[model samples]
Target chain A: MKNILFFTGRELTVEEMQEPIPDLHHFAVQPGVSDEPKCQRCGNETNFSSHPCARCGKECLYCRNCIKMGKISSCTTLYRWTGPEPDVPKAAGILHWSGTLSPGQKTASDNVLQAIQQQKEHTVWAVAGAGKTEVLFAGIATALSEGRRVCIAAPRSDVVRELAPRLQNVFPNTPPAALYGGSPDRHTYSPLVISTTHQLFRYTAAFDVMIVDEVDAFPYTFDHSLQYAVQKARKTESALIYLTATPEPSWREDIQSGKRDATLIPARYHRQPLPVPSMKWCGNWKKSIVPPAVLEWVKTKEKALLFYPHIETMEKALATLKAIDSRIESVHAADPLRKEKVAAMRRGEVPVLLTTTILERGVTFPGVDVAVVGAEDRVFTESALVQIAGRAGRSADCPTGEILFFHYGKTTAMVQSIEQINEMNKLGRQKGLLDT
Target chain B: MNRCLLCENGTEVDSWRAFFGAKAPPLCEVCTASFNRLSGPCCHVCSRSLEEDGECTDCQSWRKSIFHSNVSLFHYNEAMQDVIAQFKYRGDYVLASIFAEKIRTEAKKAACDLICPVPLAPSRLAERRFNQSEALIVCAGLTAAPLLGRHESEKQSKKSRAERMNAVQTFYPTGEATGKSVLVIDDIYTTGATMRLVADALADAGAASVKSITIARSGS
Candidate 1:
């Protein structure tokens, strides 16, 4: 068993906390990374960082930031990484290649490879355009070489469509089965099966290597039953790999504590830094056909996506935009021709496509700008906003673009999402892993 | 001396309950043979063993079941019926486990590829906070396949045999079973209505064959 540290007020080594289940955790910090920034109390700057606090000898240190926000009273906690890093076998045959893997991708792939070799569970979190699909090929190839059945499960049907061809090319000799609500070749069986997570429920201790992509996305992430189903489908000896861009705080804690093995990919695949979405307050935005500045921006943006929270507002927004310039079309879940309309936008037949969160994932274009009219809407959580912003600059043709979240009042999720994107970018830049 | 349940002539060996409680007096050999004959002739289709005929008259003919066979352990006597009701309503999970263990031994003969419990409608699951069939599966130490019963229909308790058969076709298995042999499990088998219908559902979902096992079989 791997050793991991857990903190509760006092710094205790992983060996100390032998309790079966712990209570509400304060913080899960990496072990031995005690580069304390500054002390809020006494305004004292401490450079001498050690396992134990210098003054109080307490391992938990409350930073100046939290103190300034009057949140320092809460106990500070640290979590140490515990999982083993195993080496994975190499990929066989001409592996399908459609994307690039930055240093972060290498880290993720390496972690996954190790997990597979050791028969341990691991998580790989890469920002959108981090080439999540490409990074997985090596690890999957490793598992396949060991005569293990690999399953790549996603939450969305569209994602399955996008990965089908790429996976088919990667495992060229061994035909992979694509399973979803509607797939003509679903009947054909293969060792490597790509299916929606819901489809996993039908299986019993089937896959030896189950890779759940977009683990933090809809359906799979939100539905408890679906999560249970994935676990049930996994054989007792199998390693479950969770891949996602935006992981919830608890999962991050689990990783920090070494309770779970996690590899973070903070950079995009193309080596270009992710575009940061600037916040704009369009005051009484509904009254105007288009704000002068926004209108000018739209005219210049050859390909752009407009997001509306509600269907009724989307209809009005589409009508208003069309009255000013007749090149706008709106699509929602209820739209009969949603697939066709999305296809049209992808082909550049329509310049601006207004949509809901339904288009938050799956569909991708080379270069398209995105704007959310109501950033603070109920549907747009921190996770949703990050995914929406991720859609802005994803393609090889147009890897760098802009994302705008226009709102009357901003929520914590909106602010947090921007911070997370910037934080990932900063981490990438610091490591010199940002796409050139 | 306690009498045997199957044959009143033999002395009762201490039951598992009495043995576990350290109250066992020694089993009578005659009682063992009598209890072994506890089983009776059941309906070929529903497992409701008949008295005169080998198979019950109701299910003598070939029926439409992807599940070609069915089996049950105990006859639905007052004690068994009471135990089932208590297992579900009184949260006596141990009883369900006991029932499942009995069913598992009986089902092992079939060698089914997968175990599918008769799905509880979402509405019933919400009300009870658990699936009765799921409890038995766990008790049986069987792998419970992920199959959902959608669109709530009339309860089986109120429906007649024909109505239950008609309603079974509507219970669709969400995913394809890929022609695997499936064994459906439930706590009790009444008119064999639920089993026949569940078999049909499995067949519709591309199951190659279906078989059923229940904790207890209802006597006519």
Candidate 2:
């Protein structure tokens, strides 16, 4: 039944269910947070609190980490379905994308398919604009054909929203259920699921193949609970595909030491090298007025995205930039007009968009130059700088664009981002993936 | 690092001051600003924000009521609604601390002999895992006197204002209330129906006076 399918892989509290089912699996909501306490839903070991419970009339320990998903206390009962797995119709001729994959994408796609078939963990260390999503199409199609559930989880809702339609276009026969906070398709059951990583807290062993896009993106790379959610959302023996433009330093070492399996695509599908950021010393842009170097860069009249460390600084600078051009807009994560501003930039209505690091990735603005006003700020991590540079030179017609890093003093992230870009370019040329 | 209980942002406080004081403030400045404190020209009886200083319509209608007055701290705006939902409905007990200081101040001003939390029905208690009123009292460093027991009734949140007014009294005295000034503590004073019912029951039990203090007061 549709109702049973909804509960197939979900862990819901008794109260959330409204009424107790006749026969199903039930477990202690909180698994004793006293001795090495951990949240069963999110696997958060810390951030636990206790209060006197009226249900059991005892002190109940609850997890504060995943409380946003609804509180899970020691006194509550969590229900799951231990019955037979729901019947998922095998989807054939699922992938309908007509676009062809480049040689680099083809190799990575083959590796992804192999990983899915063998149920092994693999990483796709592809550069930004390298068509990483296309690499997953074959594997997802193969998995769905076998009647196995697949999940493509991203760290941010923005990425999930951007990915859902593209995946739906390719897999026409199997429309993936997209899940996020306040999403309309909450209870839809489908073979393929596209969801934000936060939504995975309610799922348990739901996917046969789990693909985590933007694995190095914020709150995913920083928050350990998101990683735990990915692990928990997958079956006991399932394949994992970690897609990221820049992996963490430790993961790079693991790839080199042969401890992890990986496939690297160093070039974009356009066969052009990534734009390397050039650092220019601009003294004290925060305290003083917008530096002359930044002014000169803006005067070039190329549609650009100027990244700032914080929203306050970006908004303060917006007035000066708007004096130069009224069409210039500023946006941040909390800005209600974020989507509209980004769209305005995409439509080339805005000359330059000043923003915080929220716009560093998962957005494509073709033929736009990129610059970081405060490249020395700690918020601009190495991967962030690289992703910011990747925003340029995306469209094949205009295969090259400038990336400027204007700063008081270049930080290690700036130097490393440039080095990584050059290294990827070098590798791309050597592998014949780039037009030298 | 001390994080805010509401927003989870790092709460910056002087270390020495916190070390010397009872405890650091539980919320950051931004989150604290979201709570709209009741101030200037509120109703004398129910503390509802009014254009001029006088009793509100609801309090005016309760001219024959037994309770003297109700003092509430914050206006039941959207932020207070979310706070109450998290604390009472979602069972996030730690959120009760957000209102601790304000509740403590209000309760002290009331100066009642007995601090009584409006009891929840046994079924509601079993579902929510804690009596939110009791949690508010205890978290505010005030001892709660379980002076009332609630009979099984439909949830007040599910009922309309007219229905709540016409509904039968649900609370009965569980402890001695003779000649005692009772200050009833509840999370939100919505319709004044539940509070008046509790006050009537306490009055029937021969309490000297009944005054109430709530964290938030909804404009009925």
Candidate 3:
């Protein structure tokens, strides 16, 4: 029973003094030194502390509108207001940012930002861990500052949860609300909302800007209804941006043929070369135990996420691994405590985590590695395999990593994934985005 | 041109709308109403609007149909057929929402416990990357459980009616909805064969009752 605290924002306590912690009466905002703090809602500057709001308060500094609407309970101060409203960066005044754009993030961010500003549509194709989220931070801030409702929708709840903190960090002054399964703040009204794509059905023309992450991820990629939801949720003149690591063949053709404007971010943030996962054929891979080379590699690595094609195989593999070393554990979709298992891996509590494709994207672990069993299996399509490989080599602290593919035979998909990685590397190098 | 299902020939029309010209052969408001009207009668079991009797002979015998009830929006003619074809073959996923809105108007009177879509076997699903029927249900503001008929079988297109009827018993339900009524959905109702098999399977799985909701019913 260890504390499971996650980093939602740059530890605000360290960065800003007197960051207001939420309270029942009023949220803690940066209370200025005038011996009196003004209520942003009521416009009352004095005699509002520990007493009912003078103008219309049921509770101390609570607004009449908030009290009438009964939404007063859930309104937590999203950010610590640091200075006068105009002193803080507004939408247009924020400084233009142009740095060494990691090849993968460059064109995608620029094209998407332009599309949003011009009220057009654009698609972004990049490999996983290509820093897709980080690239859009500036553009998202721009949209929010302009008073546009912005939304970033992912296909998976786990991904939505993973992205919330990263966004919270970059936009510390503008706390972004994360919406997903069972989240307390899911219904919280925020100008910017990060949610699972399925949640888009609840809105219509609700956002002036929409960025759909993992456009090619299941079940959104495969589910047409959800795709329609993404389109239906946007305003008439709103910009729609699609971001995907593995754009399907049709989308690729659309980009190349100039029917759709697309930009590619072909490199990861760390700039360390993506590991080339070699296909190791162990004939009758299912029946055979972990190959000697692969086993030895796993033993040598301090920690790893061993991906099996199926849960049954993973259970068998886990039992076998535990027999060798009791520290090994397996995880799959049906496991109720999958989060706990993943957290254990993050905390270095588990040496190896055997799982299905559920951990393929979004989750990142520093100093950890990956190896796939039955890599040529039906589940290991090019996209799935590529995403699994991308899980490695994400953390800047441990950029160089390994991906071992244990297969019965070299399927076309297995070769294609490796080729795609190599192709991206070539593109990255050509763009001079590769690490020297 | 395809024998003009709505209007037999131009001589039969008194007046024609400009949209329906020579090749299309106007339905001549009168003939159009006669065909479009569902007020006359319908099958007691299937609820398919019939031209005469309240119950079509198809529902009189269980031997003729395994489906407990079947309901369709229209007699699959050129227009309805084209719309459905566009949705399936053309990747017009948006049509699902449009179709759903129409079905909602028609579904306001009738009721069922749950709306379940015909499950596409895993292989077909992988190839198409989606279940068209499921998409339609989603558009209709309905949730589709999609859990039925685990095993794969020969494509319904390749089998004869009797073969299809024989194959129907294996539709097998997972009993996810044991006591609740089910409103099964499909793109089209042809010969009522597939719907019958699904209904029988649902009953076997202990569904209180089963009814069908289809976009088009083929006019054989």
Candidate 4:
């Protein structure tokens, strides 16, 4: 029965299944990747290749794009449990969070709850550090009370990791299954699931309420396969809520034109404005010594975060910065000690941590001044710059901090990031959500 | 807008290479560097890395080895293991193209009259959809002479070293192996048990000489 529950909402191959079932539905694995080729799993259409298949004894086409998940060859069969759906019990006291939400978060949270009840698509365009995760708690609790499955998916694994404990703590009665590439709870069956967007490829019509956080983040925004997976993971008549600090330009236009329904939270939970980044010209910071302004900021003895465009530049800068202060360290995506470094910084051990755009979002340090060494780099998009600035002024005790953009030349993204912050501040003030 | 097949990163195609109508390299420089090329002193029989120019311990124990020698391009290191897993177990058929140029060079160097891929059992072939060795040979733009057939047996990965070495011969020659130099191609040469059995079958079929080329050679 437990095995049956595990396969209830999943489409798996025979080799992937551990137990044998009495009756199961079968579908073509490749499913016409040749004539009008399209991948059933990731919805990839362009990248397809054919190979001599031993099962069919002919050249069969397969989708190369989603081959990482497991090759779905033309002759293979995909199995699914077509019996009755798993019966999930409604739990009492699903949400145990005692913290109060700000007025902006309340409005957005109410909108999310309403969308779930109506089974409609909605967007929560909340500012960073605006208690975005808290807004989803109310909606998730409602969905759980009705015995409906709910999933909160994010583009990056870091976001999923950050949200897992918080969701687990609040939902004390119903433990959530945190899913990623190497998650231990991959086989767990739970009403509430927190997973990376890429993990949804194994699920089909699994969740009744699918909440996609950080929807505009990279790899999810640029990759169509992830977008298709999100759509396929949820039931046909399900609530889809998109949560983002910075929505894309096209989405923003739709919101403005009233074509898309959205709730905007313009202020942080602390009721303080997002720290605007001030531009500074640091001449040839790459080829020359460390900038004088950065050195001066280091002299202040306050904890800070310095961002560079590339890992090479960051490592080079780390050499000079470490000479000045022995405790300074740098981290990148591939650094094996990334977790230890980040944990040390959170414990107030590392004074200045140099990093790449991997830390642009989903990280917070109280009362730390932030600086972008190469703000004009193409990697620093308008959304990225805004998220980097949001890293400051997070904690209520330290709701104001300095943000500096030290660049050789300012790009349009830099200017737009500043303008977007100011625009949000103005809106917060108009809505009486920010302190005068 | 060519992308590396392994890393999916955008690969830079030089104008000169594109001007000569050469196919874009399947891997980028970073991905290419991860594969440790087999070099230095190696076993003359199995191509395993050795301290000096001599036969490895496994080759020394062979009582009646029929194959002349085995040539491998890369070490079966962690990176090569990952590549083989994705290409074979995962059925990413296009990934066979990554070894095309290297296999071509090795095959030419072997200079055998016929190139034969170690065959897969009928049931195993039906399950995996394609024979990895056959795909490797075909992708390298070489004709794969289906000169051998294999009987159903337990997977090599599932068996222990002793079990694999002592297993009965499974391969039987099927094509014209009489009086012709045959070169057997396979994806990996682990323990050399499978290759030995394959070579024995070819030799029994009256082949002039049997040589082998593998993409990777395991340390064992």
Fraction of true contacts kept, per model?
0.00, 0.69, 0.00, 0.96
Of the two candidates 2 and 3, the one with more favorable DockQ, higher being better, is 2
What's the TM-score of every candidate structure? Answer: 0.53, 0.90, 0.53, 0.91
Worst 10 residues of 3 chain B by lDDT: B1-10
Supply candidate 4's per-residue lDDT for A18. Answer: 67
Per-residue error (Å), model 1, residue A157: 1.3
At residue A170, give the lDDT of candidate 3.
Answer: 65
> What lDDT tens digits, residue by residue, belong to model 3 across residues A226-273?
676677667788988888988887888898899988888888877777
Name the regions of candidate 2 deviating beyond 4 angstroms: A16-36, A292-302, A322-326, B1-3, B7-22, B28-41, B48-62, B75-81, B149-176, B190-194, B217-220
Give per-residue CA lDDT, model 2, range B1-220, as digits (tens): 8898887588867878778774667888988899998899988888888899998888887747668888888888888898888888778899888888888998889899999989888888887888889999999999999888989989888988899877799999878889989999988887788888998889877788999988898855
Q: What digit string (tens of lDDT, one per residue) describes model 1 on residues A1-436?
A: 1112112112222322445534324323432223454432222243211222222335444432212112121133233222322222334334666655677788888888888877789898888878888778787887777767788999977788778888887678666778876677544556678888766644545678889988988766656656766776677998889988888888878877988878888888777788888899876565663556566667777788888777877787777678756867889986989989988887898888889889887667778898888787888888888888899778767888889988879989899999999998898899898645
Tens digit of per-residue lDDT, candidate 2, span A27-109: 32334233467777788887877898877778889988888788877665566667777766766437798899999999999
Per-candidate interface DockQ score: 0.01, 0.66, 0.01, 0.77
Arranged by TM-score, best first: 4, 2, 3, 1
Better of 1 and 2 by DockQ: 2
lDDT of 3 at A371: 89
Between candidates 2 and 4, the one scoring higher on lDDT is 4
* CAPRI quality level assigned to candidate 2 from its DockQ score: medium
Model 1 alpha-carbon drift over 4 Å, by segment? A1-100, A285-296, B1-220
Please say which candidate is ahead in lDDT: 3 or 4.
4
Q: Who is ahead in lDDT, 1 or 2?
A: 2
Q: Answer with 2 or 3, whichever has the higher TM-score.
A: 2
